[model samples]
Target: MTLSSLPAPAAPTVSPWTLSAFWFGTAFHWLLLLIILIPANVVGFVGEANKGTYLGALTAVGAIMALVLPPLVGAHSDRTGKRLPYIRLGLAVNLAGLGVMALAASLMTGTNGFLVYVLGFLLVQFGNNYATAPYSALIPQLVPPSLRGRYSGVMGMLQAVGQLLGAVVAFAVGTLNLPVFVSFAVIAVVLLVPALITMRGVPETATPAPELAAGPTLSWQQLFSYQPFLWVFITRVLFALGQYSVQPFLQYYSVDVLNQKDGVTASSLLAGCIIVASILSAFLGGRISDRVGRKPVIYVAGTTMALTAILLLIAPGFGTALALAVVFGLGFGAFTSVDWALGSDAMPSAKSYARDMGIWHVAFVGPQFIGAPQGALLDWGNRQGDNLGYTLVFGIAAAFFMLGVLLVRNVPDTAHVKTAKA
Candidate 1:
């Protein structure tokens, strides 16, 4: 069942839609491309691109930029005491970047595929990455602590919805892929404009603890000083890398391996299962994290994501793979269920929420650059008769989960920050 079908959390002070907006961002945020790319991410890189390495390198450059932009912009926002300016500017970048990608994709289909493909992908990623930095950090200002877990669940749920919608939508529009993608982006932008307009005068909460902000004087060194916060970045990077490897290859498995005809039925079912499970997991998982603790949830998600990735690799057919998608989504829902709250806790700077989040974002976005191509290459190599190549990639994904377990092990749980209702 979809998380949207689940009962509401106990009375939250923040209007439900506010939290819903936060959660909904996930689904709508990249609703434009994720669905089409998610199942096809692997195929696009390995089979279609035929130049994974070059495309990967370019994607990496853009991904890296996204990683670093958040903290810088956020800190600047903190200094300015305003975030909308940066938000608006970044949104503009997002629009321009999507436009380039559409243009690039259109060009690649006919000829000179390599150069145009790389450039378009790079531009789209660059814009999204840059914009996302400040976007994530802005959450704290919007949601209250009593509702962090619930809010996070909403965020996770919306994201899954986006995936479900995007996947089904993509299959229908694959023939008109370019315009479909552009329209998706355009709609996202339209949604964003209204959201931002709503948030125009809305104030976000800053750090309540004096020690965390240094008695009113905020400094970058103090912000970066928290080692645990840095550790979040470490885990984020691993998560991104592992995710990247699996996402791009899913399409390849369906098309080249399973030999499924290109249709919304197959893609939608695949995307739908993963997202549906993820949203359910995300909703309950966030509250569970709130109850038992965040670290435990992270562990659950990490291991689940890792195991499922491997299962898909070893499984004999699409049925098993589809089943695993549900499992994978469950794991992801659990981890990300409270990930944003955990991320906020790790932030060392009050003023630069976006900046620090942005800096931390690298761990999430960077891997996509390398992971996509690497998965493709491994698949490409395995297609040549070496099982170890693909196996190794999945293995590494699992290893990253293990590594994340270690990274968050020492992190202090925020359970006492607010007790969950019995």
Candidate 2:
């Protein structure tokens, strides 16, 4: 049926959001982070020889899910006209995976337990991506373009909160004892189930797909033809290259380059600084984007963060390193806040919001596919004398960030343009 055939709801001149819309952000982030942490220690302890193979294999599996599931689920949601049901399904998959992981750990010992953990991990990745694709599509629907920046800012804060909470859980559940891991799973479900319950009742108004119904059903090929959407995807992937590449190596950098006595502690402090700064900036930057524009904020953020990547290479001491962390944190926070809003603004088709968003989701997940290659580069560089690997790592990260900034120009910016309603 054509979208025009579908009944239309009263169209608001301008879209706006109440404060409660942001609650989804907090719940989504918290549960996602909690579930991820559940397997981190197991992954980390794999011997160096097999570590690369296991991680590479796992990342490939996870990245495939990341790239494929979001849009698939998103497209499904768009067709079905019910977002929450898919969200609930994804959560159930996630919870099932967590249960199997806990069960396997309880029944098996040593490497056998770890093997089951791997299976569970893959399932969790699949479920999370499926859930996240549909859930993310909700943002554009719930918050109007006029208020998207502010909404994104709140989402950013929620993301920070989720990260902090996840970190706390990881620390608390250190060593991955079977009982502790089980308890961790229980706690995650307890927290997340309620959030899902709350979201189930949040009242999403389904808009008729006039353009979508009139046109051919949304196809991947059709989605890719939109230049602005393509650029948005490119920029996001570039940004991910810079961000995720460094994340895995920071602790190693702390110990080898900074001579920190406690690598883990130092890395955590640096990460904490970045998180705190991001929380503030995301809130502030989103507000600023509302008044100014999304691109300008991203430009400033991208530039600042790119420079910080350089500073990481040159920092002489822990104090200098910590200061750089603050700078990176601020830049990253600003970027995080505006990132999604910009994506929302750049969408090619409102009728396919979830499906289009699923396409956008590839950028974040694409990194997983490429991370092994990036790590390989780091490894190759490290084999050379004088920590050249670290230099190459940060240098590559900086280049990716700059490339993202340049690509930003190609994307049609909606944050600056006003519609009749806006």
Candidate 3:
């Protein structure tokens, strides 16, 4: 069938979410970083001797689930027109996985521990993606286009705050193996309960069942032909690749390369600095994107990230790393806040928002899978002697960031396009 033959999607009639609902809805993400990603990294670092390879394997395994599950559930949600049910289901799975992770890490030994942790993380990844995909779709579905930037900013703020709190907790538990896992498990529940409770009052804005009878079916060529979306997807894939290439190892780098006696302190300090800067930038970047547009903000963000990576290569000590974290945070905050809004603006169709967003998510998770190769690079580099592996990773990361900056230029700011059409 020709692309024109597909029915135009119905205009979305979603209402603005209340501040309370927004807060609760987003709170889940804040805790997600601390409970899931941070703990997984720490576990990977501590669980095995070859930290790079072990961490890589774990992340690679989890990436498969991250890649597969969300889009499936998201597509399902698109058809069923229910977002929260998946979220609730994901919560149960995540909580169960968290408990199992804690128990596994505590009871298992050596390689056994590593395997268990990997298993637990796969579950966490599944649960996390399942819940998050729908939540992500909510922005485009519910938020008025005019307010998308501001709303994204607010969401970014919540995420930054969550990271800040998570950083504090991560530092407290730093490298303490079972305690870190246990803490994450407990905190996940503590934060999640209120989020779920608060979200209970928020309305779901799914397409009606009758309306979905003849939903638009997209061909691969037709889907890829959407220039704005293609660019956005490509941009994020590069961004995630660069970001994760270094992210999982920052703590290890701090201790192993920087020679910090305390790895946990170093990691927490870096995260804290980024969070502090991100807190302000997240709000401001989002607000600014509303006025100026997303492309420029994203360009600035990508550039800042590239510069930050370069600085990491030459950073003198802990103090310098802290300072550079500020730069990184500024760029990250802007990119994260504005980029999300950009993605929403670039949605190909409201009828398949969840499904398309799932494909979009592949950009984010795709990097994790791609980055597994970097672990081999890390191992190869470290084997060569003078901590060359660390340097190489940062260099590659910087290159990726720069490339993303260039790519963003091609993606039209969908907000402006919409305005032009209006």
List candidate 2 stretches off by more than 4 Å: 1-44, 48-57, 100-111, 171-183, 186-194, 204-217, 419-421
lDDT of each: 0.60, 0.67, 0.72
User: Least accurate stretch of 10 residues (summed lDDT) in model 1?
Assistant: 1-10
Kindly list the per-residue Cα lDDT of model 2 for residues 1-422, writing each as its tens digit: 11222121233222223232334334433333323333244444464434333544555566778877888788888887777777667777767776776666556656777778768767777876777777677666656667778778877776665555544444444334335455546544554654555455555544334643343455677666666677888999999889866776665677778998655456656776777777799889998998888888889999999999998998999889988998898999899888888877766555677888887978877677655666666667777778787898789899999999988988775566632236
Candidate 2 residue pairs in backbone clash? 3-213
For model 2 the TM-score comes to 0.84
Best model number under lDDT:
3
lDDT tens digits by residue: candidate 3, 1-422? 11221222234344233322434323443343433354345455465356677666667788887788877887888878888888777877776777667766566656677667677777777877787677667777656566778877876776677677767766666556445455756566555765565356556554433443344646556667878778898999999999888877777788777888777667788988987898799889988888888888888989999989988878888889899999999998888777667888877666777777777878887688645677778878988988888889999999999999998889866676453343
Per-model TM-score on C-alpha atoms: 0.81, 0.84, 0.88
Error of 3 at 53 (Å): 0.6
Best by TM-score: 3
Better of 1 and 3 by lDDT: 3
Give the TM-score (vs. native) of candidate 3.
0.88
Cα distance off (Å), candidate 2, residue 376: 2.4
